[model samples]
Target: MDLIADILLAAGALGAGIYCLVLGRRLNRFNDLEKGVGGAVAVLSAQVDDLTKTLSSAQNTAAGSAQTLTDLTQRAEEMSRKLEFQMASLHDIPDTPAREATATPAAPVSAQTTSEPMFVRHRAAEAHQ
Candidate 1:
């Protein structure tokens, strides 16, 4: 009876040792997985920061471009107004040289001579007459 009891005690001790070994391996694997997760989180945080900076720069550049376009449009409109005024003033210039060139006095012509034939359709005479 003593010999059988000793054999059973030895078998129990061996089983406990194997269980502890397996538990230790599992703990090590869990620690390794935790370290991998931590590394991945650090890399992702850095990438997020880089993306944020790029977005801010793009926003500033877009705002500046919009302002420049607005200013250029205003300048173009002003130039168009000045050009219109200059064109209106140009209509009065044809008689200036004639006034300056003629100095001799002459008798007035008859109304018949003053009225000439119409080069195109006489819309000017028709509307006034």
Candidate 2:
């Protein structure tokens, strides 16, 4: 009976050792960096870091664009105000063709220049008015 008990105990120990060896190999595969959960975690972490940098750069670019647009808007408003003032002054003046004709008397011509006769140009303009 003693011999049988010892043999049984040895067999149990051998079975336990085999089970432990198999479990250790499975655990090593689960933790492998190249083809396991560890590899997936590493890839995900790198992607997250890259996304964070991209988001930061995008925000900076937007802020710069906003500042530039604000400056352009202010400059446009100033130019518009100046143009409005000029238009108002023009509205106050009379639209008189005779006043323009008489303001500076025509210079006496010797009738030698043939490029264009001044009186003919003046007549055509007066016809338009």
Candidate 3:
């Protein structure tokens, strides 16, 4: 009976050792740097970093564009106000001015007419002189 018990104990120990060896190999593969969960985690981390940088740059560009648009809007409003003032002033002016009464009667214009129209062109250099 003692010899049989000792043999059974030895067999159990051998089986446990084999099981431990297989589990250790599986754990090593699961945590491998390449073709494993660890590799996927590493790739995802790099992608996150890249996306963060891109988002920051996009925000900066948007801020600059907003500032430029604000400046342009202010300039447009100022120009609109000036134009309104000019239009209001235009309303104050009369369409026709009062002509002074002449003592002598005006002569009638000639009835002569021409079929062809005439045009005059002046040179820039001659006009200055």
Candidate 4:
């Protein structure tokens, strides 16, 4: 009976030792720097750093663009206000000249003296003559 117990214990120890050896090998592979989880983690870490830098640069560019857009919007608003003021001033002007108001009405030209259409400067002087 003692001999049988010793044999069973020895077999169990041998099996445990074999299991430990296989586990150690698998653990080594899992942590391998070139082809396992360790390599994947390293690659991911590098990508995160690159993305962080890119994101920061993009944020800065967006901020600059926003500031520029704000400035342009302000300038456009100022121009619109100036245009409105100019349009308001345009309403103050008279449609007819003051000289025309004081002048007497001219005689109508007959088609007998002129043939085709013509434009003459200083028509008031010619009308007096």
**Which structure among the candidates has the greatest TM-score?**
4
lDDT of 4 by residue, 1-129 (tens): 999999999999999999999999999999898999998999999999999999999999999999999999999999999999999998987566778846955446485367765765888898998
lDDT of 1 by residue, 102-124 (tens): 76544354643666663669688
Instruction: Identify the candidate with maximal lDDT.
Output: 4
RMSD to the true structure for each prediction, in A, is 9.8, 11.2, 12.5, 9.8
lDDT of 1 at 101: 46
Candidate order (lDDT): 4, 2, 3, 1
Cα lDDT tens digits for candidate 2, 10-71: 99999999999999999889888899888888899999999999999999999999999999
lDDT of 4: 0.90
Model 1: ten consecutive residues of lowest lDDT: 103-112
lDDT of 3 by residue, 35-93 (tens): 87988888999999999999999999999999999999999999999999999999986
Q: How far is candidate 1 from the true structure (C-alpha RMSD, Å)?
A: 9.8
User: Sort by TM-score, best first: what order?
Assistant: 4, 3, 2, 1
Clashing pairs in 4: none
Pairs in steric clash, model 1: none
